[model samples]
Target: MGIIQDITNIFKTKPKKEQDKAAVDRREKQDALHKAFSDIQQQRLHGIISTLKELSTNEEIKANLKQTRHYKEFEEKVTDIIETYNRKLDHIDPSIKESQKLTVLPIVEAKLKELDKWCEEPTKTDKTLIWKNIGNVIKHSLKAIKNIGNKGYTDEIEKVRYYMKAVKNAKQNTKEAKEEVRGATKTFNS
Candidate 1:
């Protein structure tokens, strides 16, 4: 029974290599899906831009609009939209300059480095809270990265900011509590 239980446990917990391979596979799948979605969005934006350009160049439409006081405003708005969409397309284009892209691994690694520095200092907060906050930060950061070019990206980034603030607040509260405890102990002694 002991040997059977041990075998079952071993099978239940995946080997490190298998787990690493599964993670790699999952990431690859996610990246591929993201690229596909980005490509589709880029194509749709290009189509919209082309349609707008065609309408803008139409002489009859241009002549009709030229007579209106708002013609200049319409032209300006259309131009602005085109330019903005083009910039967005450039941002999502994988072929763009490397500097323009957000590399997730490096950013996460930098954050981890900061976390290491912060962890070196002991605090009164429980170990679980510190670890939980750290996990939340990483979670939100990844969510932000996953949402790049999407409407939710800003929201995810904001969540990460909130978690960071929470950590800071936790540390501050712990210090204040410690100080209060020390004062009470002194008063008791007196």
Candidate 2:
């Protein structure tokens, strides 16, 4: 019986300690990876926010943001996060993977969607032109009104008169060109 008991003990020896140690090692690796990924995510998020702030005020920076390469960098960073989490999940259970996906995917999708929308807007130059043309007209009108009080309205009136004369000349030239074309067409058809 004693010999049998010794044989049984040898055969039934527990592997719980080794299993626990392996679990600890796996957890340590996962924690380190998560920490590293968190750091990278922090840096990337900071960079993107800073870039966005600059872009909001700087036309050149805004143009850069519209570039495909910049968005591609953002995509790569998002993909990195997804891949990192997937690798970490390989060491974890199924339940945790679902939770991680729930937390991460939506945030990534929303950010990308915002960037895409911003890219679809008109370029800074077009916006600037629209504002400049409208603003100039408003400024000129205000100046003309102010000149009426100063009795210096003659200069503004002359400017308008010159502008009108230029318009009339352009219209006259266009009419002449159309008449010449019509005469040439009639001659050719005849």
Backbone clash numbers for all candidates listed = 0, 0
Clashes of 2: 0
Compose the digit string of candidate 1's lDDT tens values, residues 1-190.
Answer: 9999999999899999999999999999997887776554444334434544643565644654454454565466556555655565466656653323333224333543443344333222333344455446545655554565688866876776676555546555567989999999999999
Superposed by TM-score, candidate 2 places the C-alpha of residue 161 at a distance from the truth, in angstroms, of 50
The parts of candidate 1 lying over 4 Å away from their true place are: 87-190
- Residue 165's lDDT within candidate 2 is 36
Report every candidate's CA lDDT: 0.55, 0.46
Find the 10 residues in a row with the least total lDDT in model 2.
129-138
The residue pairs that clash in candidate 2, if any, are none
Among residues 3 or more apart in sequence or in different chains, the pairs in candidate 1 whose N, CA or C atoms overlap within 3 Å are none
